[model samples]
Structure formats: C-alpha cells, structure tokens
Target chain A: MPGFFKNKVFWSGVMALVATLILINMTSSERENITLLERILRDTYAPLQSRVTEMRDYLSGPRSIFIQKQELSERIAELEEEIARLNLSNQILRENEEEIKRLRSIINFRDNNLDKYELLAARVIARSPNNWFQSIIIDKGSIDGIEKNMPVITSKGLVGRVGSISQHTAQVNLITDREIAVGATLQRSRETSGVVEGMVEGNLLKMINIPYYASVKPNDIVITSGLSEVFPKGIDIGVIYQVTEEPNGLLLSATVVPTVNFSKLEEVMVITDFWPVSEETEAELPALAEE
Target chain B: MCYLIHFLLPFLAVFLQSTVFGFYSIKGTLPDLVLVFVICFSIVNGAGKGTVYGFLCGMLEDLYLGRFIGINAIAKALTGYITGRLQKGFFRENIIVGATAVALGTLLNAAVLLVLSRIAFPSFHIDEQFVQGVLYQFAYNIILAAPLYGWYYRSSRIGLLKLPGEK
Candidate 1:
C-alpha cells in the first residue's frame, strides 16, 4: 500500500537495506573500476577542489612571506659563512672534473653508458578523509602515463605506488599503509634479504624474514631488493631503527624509519621506466655485455 | 535555491576539510567538519530529510576518496536519522540538546566507520592513539555544534535565541 511505503520506519528500513548492499558490493570489488556516478562526481569535484586549494594557498602566501622575511636574514648570515668554503671546494671540483673528463676520454666512454631514469613529477591534490587508510590523490593519472603499481618517490626516498588511476588524478597508497609490502635488503650485506611491511599502529615500517645469523644492526641502510615485480632495485627505502630476534630463532625482524616524510609530502616523482634485475640476471649482465 | 544551498554547504565543508583544514591537524587527527554539518543539518530537519542529506554528503565524500563507496554514506545516514528522531523528544531550541546530539552522533558515526573498516580491511587494528583521536573528535564536534546550530537556526528562520522560560 502507498501508506505502508510512506511510513518513516518502512522507508528507513529500505534505505538501510540498500546501503548494506552497496557496502557489500563496494568492499568486494577491487576499487579500480569506479561506477559511472562516482567517476562523474570525481571528475566534477577534483577541479573545484584544486581551484579552492589554490585560492587558499594564494591567500596564505602573504602571511608566509612575512615570516620568511624574518627567517631569511638569519639564513643569509649562515650562507655568507658557507660561501667562502664553497668557493674553495668549487675550484677543487673543477680540477677533478677535468681529470675525470680526460680519464673518460681515454676509456672511450659512450653517451649511452649512463642509464637515464624516466620520471613524471606530480603534485599531491588530496588526502584520505579517514585515518585508517594512508593515501593521497596526485594530480597526474593515466593521461600522464601514471599507471597502477608505478613506483612513486620523493627526493628523500620511496613514498608508495600508484593505486587507482583516473583521467587527471591517481590514488597513491602510502608506504605506511598496511596493505603495501616492499622487498628490501641490508645495504651492508646484500645477501641479507627481507620484506618491509607497514604497521597498523603508527607511520612505521618493519623488516621481517631476515636471517637470524645476519649481522644486521641499527642504522643499517635498507634499499629495494629488486625482488618485487612492482618496484625496481637500488631505490632508497629507509634505515633500520632496531633489531629483534623472533621467537622461532630462525628469523629476525627490525623496525625501519622511512626516509620519506609522509606528513609533509607535496610533490613526488613517478618511475615510468626502470627494469628490475633478478639475482641470476645480475650475475649474467657482465657476460652478456661482453658479447 | 534552498535545495542548492543545502547541497553546496556540505560540499564546501568537505573541500575545506580535505584541503585547508588538513594542514592544521593535531597529531594527524583533524576535526571532521562533515560530521558536524550532518548533525546540525539533521537537528534542523526531520529524520527523513536528514537521512537524505546524510546519504548525499557521504556519497560525495566516498566519490572524492574513491574507496569504500557506501561506508560513509550508511554511517552518516544512520547518524542523521538517529539525531532527527531525538528532535521530537527534546526542545529543538535548546543549545544543550544540539550539542548533545552532535557529540553522540559523532561518536556513533566513528564507531560505525571503524567497524566497517575492520570488516573491509581485516588487518586494521585499533590502537590507543585511534581511540584517543575519536574521543578528541567527539569533543571537537561538541565545541563546533553551538555555533553551527545558531547559524542554521538563523538561516532556517526558526527563531534564533530561546528567551527566558522558553520551552
């Protein structure tokens, strides 16, 4: 009956049921394929949000400029002291460069000897509303060749990888997110391979599956192991803060302090082209080059 | 015009929270203005209308984030419905009633979100900081409720101030 449908309780129950179905469907999906409504809403709001953000920054610039002026005086004093030291170092560096050029010419170095990393720079546009998920939306997406699983990093270190890509934006899962797993190894001893995982509590990474006998200690640098299909090798990950022996005594775990500061992240670079070398391939690289 | 303002206010609040207010977060926990808006809106409107607003606001947020599409929508809608149901039992003109509704509604919304997050991401574990942050948000919502309710009341032409002996 129309009366029954009009009842507040009836409508409330119906809405509840509809919401439950949506939640179930959404959670089960991989979240990459957004619905038409979602896509439209995202496309519509992203530009508005960008404009508003720019306006806010523009408004705040004057106040920041005043503060920077006071700070700049002190910075200038320190820089003046450094200029004399740098002048001497600059001369020494010029002499070293000439010597290196002569040595390189003797070795007959080619232009292709240096491997150039192809990168795309992007600005962070937004952050997740909830603290449960650590992610940011970058202003670049498929239009900028930012595909899913592409490694994103800052000048400091690795941030995360691209998750879902839209036309003009992409979601980057932070390295601190629990869902992310990174292959890492101790820089001092490359044979000591481990897996770096994010903790649920704080912005922290923990390296596990380390050999119990490996001489791992605090302050050991950790780098990408190149074992992952997603990330390439030689990327700086973090440094070990502490080492703990697992109860099994067969493996050890260490807490890592990531080099990238997630809280202050603004701009990042996406690695578009990089080949990860496997252990066997690395061993055979010199032989193959010889032929 | 009223319908457009109703939709625009929440959208603007969400945008500000995501962009500007995000910079002023305390210990990585920012006060959720969207939650405050829903509670205030629900207090002004009835249960049915509040639920609709809640759904719309939550849906917009989910779209912006592009993850867990219906989670926020369902939680906010239920919070709005619950707050709206409280209107008939208490004096709507009372600031205490409005603030109480915001505190309780925000706590409920947070609980529902945490539960849904656990269900979706099984590895998520509640830490002490998370609990503390939720409590801080509850207090923050209460502090924001008074001013927001006054603004909504003035705009709705619902008689802004309750004089002495007003029921």
Candidate 2:
C-alpha cells in the first residue's frame, strides 16, 4: 500500500463517508421538527437572500421603473372609473343577495361557506436552489402569523401549504413537490374523489386512486375534497388532462394541469385563518345558535 | 478580507442562484453555481481538499433548504471528489477540461441524489421527468463552467487559492 493511502486526507474521507451515511439515514423529507442550528442558519441567511433579490429587482432598470410608474398611474385612474361602474352593478347584486338571504331563511338553507378564510398577501422572495426540491420562500413568516400547514393560494387556485417557517420568512412546498398531497375531488362529479400528488414537473399533478368506474375525463375540474385538516373544501385544484386506468385495473388516475402557473408566481395569498366546519360539526350545532 | 470573500462566495452564489438565475430557469432546472464552484475548486485543488470543501458547501445548501441535511451534502461531496480525482488526467486550466468536468460532475451529482433518495426513502421514485430535468441541468452547468473554471484557474495561478502541500 502506498504511504499516501495511509495519510490524514484518506482518513478524513473515510470518516466523512461514515458520517454522511449516518446523516442520510436520519434525513426525512417530511421532517416536522427543525433543529436550533437549522433554524438559526435559515433565519440569518434568509434576510441576506431577500435583500439580494430586492437589489436585483432594483437594479433591473431605473428608466423602465419610471415608465412603469407612469403606466400604473394611468391604469389606476382606469381602475377607479371601472370601480364606479362595478359599484352600481354591485348595488344591484347586494339587493339580489338580500333576496337570496331572505329566501334561504324561509327554506332553512345553509350558505356555501368558503369566504370564511382571512388571506394574508406575501411576496415570493426566493425559491429552492436545487431542482430536487420544489419549494418557494415567501417574505412573510411566523411574524406575519403564518404557520406550518397553512394553505397557500393564488387568486386562480390552490398553491401549497407552509411547510416550515422562520421569524421573517417561510418555506412553502408547492403542490407539485413530491412530498405534498392534497385531498382532491371532481367538481363536476362530486362522487369522483382522489388525492392530488405533486409530480416531478412543476406543471403536472397526479390524481391517484380514482374509482375505476368514475365518470371523470379530460377537462373535468378538480377541487379540494375538504377531507384534510390543512386544505379547505371546494378550493380549485386543477383540470384533468388525461384519465387512464391503473396498471392493475383496480383504480384509475388522471393528470391534472393546475391553473396556477407556479413558475410565474410573484404574489400569493396565504390563508391565515380558516376553521372549516364539516357536516358532522354542522349537525352538532344547536338550533338556538342558528336563531 | 480575501478569506472572507472566499468564505461568503458560496452563500452569495446560492442566493443569486435561487433569485437571479431563477428567472432564466428552463423547466424548473437552473444552473447550479455552487456545484460549478465546487467542481472548479476541486479541479484546481486535489481530491482531499475538494472533498472537504464540497461537503461544507453541501452542508450550507442543506441548511439553506432547512429540510433535509445530508442529501445535497453527500451528493456534492462525492461529485467534488470524483471531479478532483479525474483532474489528474487533464490540463486543469483549460476551459474545455473544466466544462467537461462540470458536465460529468452534474450528472454524477444527480445520480447520487437519486440513488441516495431511493435508498433512504421508499416513497421516492425516479421517473421520466427526473431524467429530463437532469439533462437540462447538465446543459446549464456546462454553460456556467467556462467563466467559473477560468476564474478559479487564474486565481490559483496568482496564489489566491493556495495549493495543497505535498504529502
């Protein structure tokens, strides 16, 4: 054996191999607990990363920003005029809503309960440097009352939930990440339900374990099934692209194309407060409270 | 000051990699500036220092991710070691050599990640998209290798990157 093979460098390599193997064994993608070291590092570096992003945006172009500001002012005026037109239309809609409320009272009908959510707007500050993990870092964090498992959404549809959080920033695993799954249902055929899983690609989602005989097909809209503790019921998930029978013929699966263009995600709304009431909870409610 | 610049280089590279390079991503895969640096440093240095530095950089990446600890660390360190060992057969300062090393390093990095994940977690499955993403990253890393390797090669020539002392 060569003398170099017995040197300190070789011993270091061997030690590293052993330590890394042990570390990999302890690694978990669904880890709920964050250690003190990881927390401090993420918190300390996240701010610098956020500032670098702002600097990049600032240095993009001063002239372009001025032009954009002028255009935005003109657009704001246009929007104000449109808002007045909408206010007239909204007044008529308010009368219709009041009529509906009265009719519902007469019929003892339950209101569609989705707007109970309070949304907090957050900016996309950074994204995962590696492609193996599909996560985005938002500027808002626990300081903004964002917590783990909080559902994140855009105006178009569901994005993902907060996975981990620091003081000033939070990491959201996108719905297309491998480790995330949402309770999904078919909007057209309420009976057709499945779990929407994140796929390797950012655009594609896999709706798994659909009943073999369900009437789901391409163009069918998929929504949240309200079956999970995290995601609210009736939030749009995606449109089914291709439905196919599973290899075993026991269950079917479909490819759902999400409405949210995740790559282009700039601003998102994190649902801060939502207490979903299930049918079980509804039945347990007292009549006096309803009155 | 020089040592501080060298120390903070990985952090800055990673931040810019996630933010600035994110805009230019091709199908969710971007050029990994940290990996490129690892390869360059390994090519200039030897397998021993390359391996240690790769491990540290990978740890930094994992900490930034705040999820898994060793996935990137193991993969990147292995890539650095392999690239460093292979550099013995090449003209280390040549851009082509550097770019070729990057191409191999990127592929090796992806393979190690895939194999490690597959072994550690049964839920993880490799699919067609994984292959496609790796290819896209391979292209991006090669594109980045030229300028990065040139800088490292020149820096080593000027003694900013102190070579490993003889055994």
Candidate 3:
C-alpha cells in the first residue's frame, strides 16, 4: 500500500484521471451560466490574447506578401462582381418602390412592423484548435452589446449565432457544428418548413423533418423559417444539394450546402437589436399605434 | 518573467491556432502547436512535470477553442505522461524520439477526444472525414515535431529548467 502510494506513475495517472473528469464536468454543465472563475479568467485574458493576435499579425505581415497579392487580385474580381450586382439591384429596387407605393395605399400595412435590427461588424480573432470549424472567437463581446443567441452573418449568408461571451470576445458557433440547428424553409415554394442540422460527415448541413411529399429539389434556396427566437425570418441559410428519403418514409431530408464559406469567414455582422415577434404579439400589432 | 512566459506560451499557441493558423493549413489539416508544446515539454521535463504541463495546456486549449471541456486536457495530459515516461530511457535530444513521441501523442490526443466525445455526448458522431482529418493532423504534427523539438531543446538548454538527464 505504501509502495503504491510512493509510485510516481500511479500519482500521475490519478491526477490525469481527476483532471479529465473535472474538465468533462465543466464542459457538460449549462453553458449560459458560466462559472465565475471561468468568466474572470476569460475576461482577464481575452485582451492579452487579442493583443498577442495583433502582434503576431504585425510580425507576420512582411513574410506574407504573396498571400496578400493573391488576395488583392481576388478582391478585385469580387469588386467587379459586386458592381454588376449593384446595377441589377438598382433596377429591381426601382420596380419594387413603385409597386410598394401602390400596395401601401391599398393595404394600410405599416412598414415599421418589420423588426428593426442593428448590425455590429466584428473581426474573426481566433478559432477552435482542431480546424473543426465548429466555432470561432470574435472580437465583439458583451461590452459591444453582443449577446448569446445573436445571429452572426456574412454578406453571403448565415454563419452562426453567438454562444458564450467574455467582456471583449464572444464565441460564434458555426452553422456547420452539430450543436446548432436552424429553422429553415424552402424559398422556391415557401410552404415547406424543416430543421437544418449540422452534419458530422463532410461537415455538411442536413435539413430534416421535411414532409415526404414536399417538392424540394436540388438548388432550391433555404432561408430562415423564423420559427425560433434565435434568428429572424428570411435570412439565407443554404441551398439544397440532394433530397433523400428516410427509411421510415414519414419524412424527408436534404443535404444543404451552406452559403457562407466557414473557412474564409473573417469579418461578420452581428444582429444586435432584432427581437423575434411571437404569433400572439404579431396578431395584436394592428391594434397598437401604427408607428 | 520565466513563469509568466510559461503561462503565456500555451495561450499564445492557442491564440495563434485560432487566428493565424486558420489561414494556413495543409490538405485541410492544421498542426496542433499546443500538443507539440506538451510533447516537447514532457520530453524535457519528465513525467511528473510533463503531466502537469499537459493538463494545464489542455485546459487552456479547452477554454479557448474546444467544443467540449476537458477532452483536450485528458488527451494531452495522458500524452504528456506517456512521453515523459519515455524520457527516462530515450535520448530527449534525438529528433526521431521527439518526432515519434509527437506522432503517438497526436493520435492519442485525437483518439481520446473522439472516444470521450462519443461517450459523453450522444449527439456526437464519427465519420470518414473525422478519421481522415485525424490522420492528416497526425502527419502534420509529426512534420512539425522536429523544429518544435529543436526550439524546445534550445530553450531548455538555456539553464532555465534543469534538464531531464542532467544530474
């Protein structure tokens, strides 16, 4: 017994085991209510980490000239495409403005009923270790009015929602992670609703519980159903890749190709002020002041 | 100053992993610098200190980027302990020994993470991509092991911490 206690191997093994258990317990606990120690640790160290990142970027800047050149070329091409898009958008908006005037006179619908949202632009400061692309640490946090469940987006489409926050940083759980699910609808029909879940295989998104008879097709656009409180309705989620029938035959699922490139995600906009309108509130909105 | 450097090293490694390393990857696999740090440190520090360093490094990793808590810590601590035990009979300065330790450590780290995530969370599942990623990352870690070992060797020889074999 004394010999066992004296064994260094035994002690090391015991410590490792204990540490493992403690780590698991801490992670599995409810994430919203982070422990005070963890909060303090994150708040205290986040700034230093952010500073170190900036310093590393500054130091590495001179050595990365080739990458910068390649990026500049790509940015030029993207800008050209953007210009074409803006021209098309101008034409569409002119048509929509005329139609909207006619419709507004007839319907008496209020424009302010649309949820007002504030966008906070954040930089991608850090990432998870494994290249799992599950989550990323953004430079925005509670101090920036970023809160848990706020949807993070790129101009292209949905990225993820804010999960945990420190004083100066927040973790954006990517839409590709298994833990996240978005209520989505097929844009072509707009009648079918389903849940888009992150799949482990190929890091793809899967839309589940779609009705078996829904006429979902390849390349059909998917957007937020606004069924959940986390995200507002009509945000672009992804495009359907392939629709498949389940073994049970009651429901259908589709493979979704996420619109946002998780790998190239750098700058994202956080929706800060959007409040989801419940069915009951939406019903009663007409009785209130029109403004 | 030395203690602060020791504390900052893992955080810096993770910070870099999250930011700079995200841009640079080979075949969709990135090197785990913190794991490299643990393996190299264990080889220099021996099993007892290695275990402690591994645990601390892993915890920081979990706090920074891990999806689940403690998975990296458990994997890294075990790897550190095992590599530290290897330090006794093997030449710590040898490149092959250090690189081999890193290879084993990366695989162990991945295996422990996968197995534990499976056990702890019913929602988590494994696939071919995960397996391929683990293998790619293992090779990547091995490729990085030599330079990291060289750096660790040079740092330890600066007479900061007592060398493993030095009396």
**Residue-pair clashes per candidate:** 0, 0, 1
Which pairs in model 1 have colliding backbones?
none
**What tens-digit string does per-residue lDDT give for candidate 3 at A73-145?**
9999999999999999999987987787677656554343223577899988766666554787788888888
Query: Model 1: runs farther than 4 Å from truth?
Result: A1-32, A56-61, A64-115, A189-192, A199-202, A206-218, A241-255, A275-291, B157-167
User: Per-residue alpha-carbon lDDT of model 1 for A1-291, expressed as tens digits?
Assistant: 578887888877787758665675655445656667765665666786677667767888888677766689999899998998999999998897778678656654321211257889998777666555678778887788877788898877888988877788888888887778998988998888899988653567889999899989999999887777677776788999999999999999999999987766778999887655556876775565555
| Model 2 lDDT tens row, B1-167 | 44565677788878887787876799878778899988988888778778878888998898788666778888888999999999997887689999999999998998898888887767888778778888999999998888888887887777566454522
Docking class of 1: acceptable
Report the lDDT tens digits of candidate 2 across residue range A161-209: 9988888888999999888888889999899768999887556899998
Better of 1 and 3 by lDDT: 3
Interface RMSD for each predicted structure: 2.6, 2.0, 3.1
- For model 3, the superposed segments whose C-alpha errors exceed 4 Å read A1-23, A40-86, A93-115, A201-203, A245-250, A279-291, B1-5, B86-88, B157-166
Candidate that would win on lDDT: 2
**If scored against the real structure, what TM-score would every candidate get?**
0.78, 0.85, 0.82
Best by DockQ: 2
Residue A57 local lDDT, model 3: 69
